[model samples]
Target: MNTPTRTVPGQFTIVLHSHLPWLANHGRWPVGEEWLYQSWAGSYLRVVAMLRRLAEDGATDQLSLGVTPVLAAQLDDPHCAASMYEWLADWQLRATDAATAPDPTRRELGVREFQSAAAAIADFEMHWRHGASPQIRSLASAGVMEILGGPLAHPFAPLLDPRVRQFSLREGLADARGRWARQPAGIWAPECGFAPGMELDYATNGVEHFMVDGPTLRGDTALGRPVGDTDVVAFGRDLTISYRVWSPKSGYPGHPMYRDFHTYDHLTGLKPARVTGRSVSSADKKPYDPQRADHVIDRHVDDFVDHVRRRLISESERIGRPALVVAAFDTELFGHWWHEGPIWLERVLRRLPEAGVRVGTLATARRDGYVGAPVDLPASSWGSGKDWRVWNGPQVEHLVRLNAEVTETALEAVDKLVDPAGPRHPSGYRGGRSRVADQIVRETLLTVSSDWPFMVSKDTAAHYAVDRAHKHAHATREICDAALRGRAGLAERLAHNWSQADNLFAGLDARRLYTAALPSDTGS
Candidate 1:
């Protein structure tokens, strides 16, 4: 008799891409690190709490989390570190404010819940400050989060000049080293944007695999594949599993009972909308219903598990072997954008096991021999039109032009570096000599992040994106010029000046970090 398969026998991987732009020192009180502080204080705290709660209850291990280098740098920054400490304390007050108007019995319960969040945020800050982030390190130690690496500024790697792309990934690797204090084994290729030739760079930096979207697999979403001759595996995100919780239109976040992302009460600067009511007017959104969201979470969790069950059975039948369902998402989708996100994740974690889905991280899947390869892939992006249009859209013409200059300038500087095989030892241009080159490489990568152009195109934070792209590109221009001219002292000066103004990704290599096999396009 054939053995009945009740679970997804192979594995299921969920990759959460965590990234925010380099927002240190660049903009002040309201916008920059302040925004970073909100994610750190609010979202990051919630994530850690959820992980601890799940792991404590024995859900599973090897949760794959890809924290971007730019975000890691801010987390380790003294100013950001200090600021986050204050922000957590501030979160306590907000929680208190949120709890004030509930019913008498519920008010008492709300206070306890609010206080619980307050204490957790405070404890999280304490651990992250004096030493490594408890969440980052503890999760990794438990084999809960198989940490994934990305480019220093989370740039669109394939569009960059090969050397700069190499430099960007290496520096990105270095950024991860500072926080987790360990090299990353996997990466969430920034934005799940995959270009055919980007895998060798991931291999060069010691990342075993990186993630991309489902269609890029040409229909095989559960398998991993090698890029070119490299051993690095590419994991495709399971589209069916991903859309249930947070798709563009239908998601638990859209349930009439969750906090609205669009309208905010400018006076209190809080989201004041009815969690479960139809929109009456923009001005009169109600004050968020916590209980209704809890109910919705259960229904959604059940639906999600049902989806996974059917997928597992169908895929297994097709492949003639056990199959995997890898659900990937942006981490910010959880608590930052979807206020009910953490609850949905908690319920999903709890429900999946009860439903018999063997929850796992990519590392565990790899360890268990669930890996395979299908070499060729078309050039694809996770952006609109599934192409480079997001990064090179009409709204970002200036960014395209600026990137063209930086790419050309940095490439020329790389060629000018002392020959590696020459009689004289090449400095790798270390110390002060590489400082200017470091800034050029650093600034260039930051400028080309698909995020700035992406943010502008989406109109989420358009002006800020334009401003940041120009600011970073300007620095790239100044520093790359000094490096190409062989002005060691001048290059060093520009590097220092930029650092004072924008000291992100501290462990950067000014010299071209990697050899690029891709040429950049100029006129977008």
Candidate 2:
């Protein structure tokens, strides 16, 4: 018998986008409250736990994780740091108390559950402690996970001030380095949203690899192709690879054996639904059978692995070169939307290696020479209209103009100040002598976040989102007027104004954020 000829090898990639707004003092819990009991934090903790387990078991080195700067800030927030420690301590206490409780049968179960939970929490803290967030650092260093860096605040990049947007992206990359001690080799681009020409800035900021939607790359869902000769390689997310696990209308979440997302008990505030069925009422959620769910997990994992192997073989033959399958999604979709997601992920991560499929980040792929020739890309977003609808839609049109007008006023205030070496006021903020200039810069940057208009347009907290946008814009105008008039007393008021709104680039050099490439007044 003749030996079979070998075909090109294939690859599979998954990018999980993690983000949540400045929810420090914000209210709402479980999924609300913004900051407290952060779902973003919970997701990170859980995902890290899963990765740690697999790593300890000597699993394969294939997983690319992309966390946005906005989410990273929340996780690394000093306030959040203290809160998480307390939360973990409480979890341990609860488990400990439950283990020794008065009930006989329940107590025995409690001991096991609490003991397991304690070990998890302890491992979590040990691996990802405060400041270092060891999980990100370790994964990046070990090459198991590719750290993705995004904008300063998860802004809809296309609609933001190009200058400020550029600034935000650079600053965000630096921020990621601060945590991981390694400049990110790629970014997830906030929402997998991309606009042509933006890659120029990405290249300028040292981002050699990033990802886009399959359509944007002008490729099918199963293969990733590079974009142009800019040297910044782009990987398109494979919808098949993603949808198999979680589709828009169908997914593992809808499986008969997964926990219900919308049926949590209001009074008890506990998730009481069975993975095998839907909820009847808050108090009457059917019992969940993990054994059945585990069976479901195995089935899905096998199906997913088989899909990858086939797609890989078929694609390798067609392209005449090795191919890559990238699946990207919101990290929250996991544990929050599908309670069994963590388990499913664990099961899948462990199974992929045994199945003979390789898993790795874009950096590894590129380093290994798995790339196609470059091509041009189009402007696009991952929203309803797949355009600028989220930024310029009807619900946010008026506020959008308001933002433009306010930004113009602030930009003008700085431009009109003839001399950069002029005022010597003792009250200059962060060493910038112009009291008004400082506030204008602060408010302008904060208001430019695409989240405001997006939130308003989606009717997802419309009032709050609109209020925040207008409030920041109004403050921008106020500061512009004060600075132009050379008002000295405004310092105290502006200081108080910014206390609740501290941000990463709080003392940024505004002038550096403004370049000749930006819009003159930005007022429409």
Q: TM-score for all predictions?
A: 0.87, 0.84
Q: Which lDDT value does model 1 have at 313?
A: 78
Q: Estimate, for each residue in 196-292, the C-alpha lDDT of model 2 and write its tens digit.
A: 8888888877888887876676556444455665888888877667788768566767787665666543322334456444435635655455566
Q: Top lDDT: which candidate number? A: 1
What stretches of model 2 exceed 4 Å from their correct place?
1-8, 28-36, 57-61, 86-132, 221-223, 275-284, 414-442, 503-507, 514-524
> Taking the tens digit of each residue's C-alpha lDDT, what string does model 1 give over 63-172?
68888877777776787777677766665566566567555533443465466556766666556775335468777776656788887788787677766667667766
Total clashing pairs for each candidate: 14, 7
